[model samples]
Target: MSTDGSAESRPAIDSPERIELVHVGRTLQSLQHLRVVAASLIVLYHTELQITRLTDGIHQHSLGFGAAGTDLFFAIGGFVLVYTSHNRKDTLGAFLYRRFARIAPLYWLFTFLMLGILLVAPSYLLTTKGDFWHFLLSLVFIPYPHPVLGIDRPFLFPGWVLNHFAFFYLLFGSLLFLTSGKRVFAVSAVLCALVVLKALFRDQSHLLNFYGATVALDFVLGMIVAWIFLARNETPWIIAAVFLVGVSIFATGVLQNVSEGAERALFWGLADAALLFVCVSIEKQWGWPECRLLSKLGDASYSVFVSHLFALALVASILRGLRLFPTLGVPGARIVFLGAAWALGMVVYAAIERPLMRCIDRQRRPRMARMIVAKGP
Candidate 1:
């Protein structure tokens, strides 16, 4: 099976090779749906946290598994980039350009939208205070102390993930540029060193601390998974699932007590990797059918994740105006609010984000076409 993107680059295939290709393709398709699940976990986590704050921790749950969504995303991000970039020959400049075009436009639009909201209705937004410089830094994916929250964050709280993402891209992209797609171990080594530095320098300032977090190590774990897949080609679904369950139990501290930080990262990273392994393994072994809703949700995950907070805010505002929460009670209100936020996220994805991304893609097509023509056959 070809792990890399280019099928044409593969050597001549026999019957066994053809069968393996079909299996690998199916596995990749199943993994696509996992994005929606990850995004939903984040949305749920934020919803629970915000509601707990609103209700004075009356319903706060200690588990906070939703926060683990970020870990899952880091793991998935590492895997996908390594998987997709496996055999591509695009220049680092071109690769970064494509990534920026895909990520930045929508993020800028949302950042400014949040800024405008803060200007107009500060009381409604959670992180209300802002500085012009901080806002500008946020637009460029820089880690800055969020004016209101006083944490290393941006006006758009969820956008903090982008900082880690941009750093990973710069690191990986530079390695690709320097080595021309070789020296992968150097990349892994650098990531390991960063994690170790994060552990050792826990007293650093907020911004530096955020940058050095062990969570970034999950990306390396993901790359390892991709390397394993490429090397071995397949694993049994049952074995993968069993391994995942064991990891989950251990992560939950059933066998030993565990807390946050590197401990949590080690457990969650392994658990998320096991999850990816099982999802891909199942589809490869059984040829799982397409799931339209999950696939659509996956396609819209970024939009959903970025905008769900506003959706939840709107729901809260509406409920407050109607005074329905007292009747619904805390748990009931939470359930309703989560559903409303999820629905609004889908709306944002369909109505706003999809069109905006299409416009961006269209604008890039001409430049890309010219570049392709310039490099002529």
Candidate 2:
């Protein structure tokens, strides 16, 4: 019953520890479907933009409140990266290269595509200031000066998550160098310090001031959860209880809003931290619920997320053609619009993104091969 074998291994053998005879496809698919659901939550958060329709409240009405979904992503990223890294005996250079191939090319692809759309459909652009250079700088994650939304503005508003991701890669990718025990403690320490600093210093200002660090810490929380379950072979329900407690804190309003002197930010961060723990624990205990189509959608979850905001805009425009927006404040219209945006984004991922990623992979492998050859091993 040995499950431990390389992909290249054949003729499965028996052993007390190995479950090679067993299939885990159902669990895998279940998790994949959950990933798609998380992406949907983020999209739903964005659909509110059209609902509010505050023409003059750009910064005030900006998507700052949408981070609950992004936090889920950070948690998932951390858990998945740690799990995959445990199995990857490859070199750091190769690992980084592979990860970059996974994320960057498609990001640039959509970024440029959106820019093209903006040129043709100026109404879709977040800004008309024509600060092309600033936007270009932001392509490299450099914050543009003057306009708070300057170069980062777009037809789709979710691009900032990629900027967050670039920083995540820089930090989370570095954890490979640390011993597992040390990595977990270091990440926890950082998370703790952030809350303390917020309370004592900034009074819970935008956590993004140390944005890279905070997100990385959230990822670390995931990493620690992974390590615990991996080492113990069973997740503790106490961990689940902690998450429930965090939810209680949030519900009770103990952690409401920090800027005005409420202790809410501390509670919110703790709750999210607990959520990662709970999600990982649940996945371990009940296993993922099986679904084939949803898993495939989950496989495209990254692409779906990166483009959903833009997809919403595109869908909205098409509906606008029918003069739908003015009357569509009805709950049914909102639900239909959100559902349609989600579906269209999935289609785009299936039709465009999946193929584009394959192309990127093809391009990367040859380059990696060339580098390996140049090294002359």
Candidate 3:
């Protein structure tokens, strides 16, 4: 759900004088569509879980793999950062500011909205209540134990992903202050080392445990993809083979009920990374057709992800009140819920998130222009 659909100029890695930086629009566009896809899958996963719970387990089938969308998200995030910044020069402060502006505004708005709801009608939250400290932690995108659920989640459940993203931004952005190409390796090593150390110590504390989780490796896999992309590597077949192997392993593990930790990260990360490579390669060579529906969805994906819990709650409450869910059954009710969530997200994006981003960009552009003018041609 991280959409950074912007053009940037970066020199090709080979033959420095012969190479020239150009805008890589097609890959960005493909990534936009992927963002929409990833967000939708997550929505479906959550919807399935909610519906199953509401129906008293009468709804049988599982959408367990839908959670893999989150792994793809982490990879996409790392790749986007490295790919976009490969050729362009950006200071740590500037990069951090852009990331913060992109993610925090809509997040804070929705967080406060959820907070207001908690204050006004806690029952509406439906078993996902937290104290003031949890609320504060959520605002800052920090990990904390949920008062009701006893999990490392906020009242707004999906916002837990933001905690990991915030940390990734902070760690990766800080490393950008180092010399060229060093940041990727350094960041990868640090992330991997942290996970290893965490595993060794068996620490389950909030911050360390969160950082040490296998999911963090997805970002590293993404960084590796960015490295490949930047280098213009032509090993798609090898990557594709690796992807197949990874998927096979992941599937077997899931079927056999043996998936966990490092195994999960390796298999899923390989598959996700391979997916990105293939997508980028295809789009770069063949081009993605411009689709208005996908573009809008991609633009609103962040809004959808951060705000869909509210939409889900609203939809479920209404369905429950009308006693429609049982009649609709799992599949039908899931479709309705997913559609409602997507529509509500689009509305929230159009009403608040889009305008706020535009306003901030409007203010930022003049300063950027002035700086460019001052620097001279």
Q: Which candidate comes out best when scored by TM-score?
A: 3
- Cα lDDT tens digits for candidate 3, 99-213: 7888888888887888788789987777766588988888888888889888788657888788888999999888776654788999899899989878887755667787888
Tens-place lDDT per residue, model 2, 1-377, is: 21332211223212100111122221233336546766776776676665564222332333333445565666666665565555434456655665666666667777777778767876766644355675676567543342535333332346555665665565556666776566566655665676456546652344333442344455665667667755764446686577678678555443343221233234434455566566556666776555666756666677778777677777667766776755654454457656776687667776776676566556655676687689796
Candidate 2 error regions (>4 Å): 1-31, 54-66, 126-128, 145-156, 187-216, 233-240, 249-269, 325-328, 363-377
The positional error of residue 311 in candidate 1, measured at the CA in angstroms, is 1.0
Error of 3 at 27 (Å): 5.5
Q: Give the alpha carbon lDDT tens digit for every residue of 82-157 in model 1.
A: 7666656656786676567656777888888887887898776755677987888888889888777777887678
Root-mean-square deviation (CA) per prediction? 5.6, 6.6, 5.7
The local distance difference test score of each candidate is 0.68, 0.56, 0.74
TM-score of each: 0.86, 0.74, 0.87
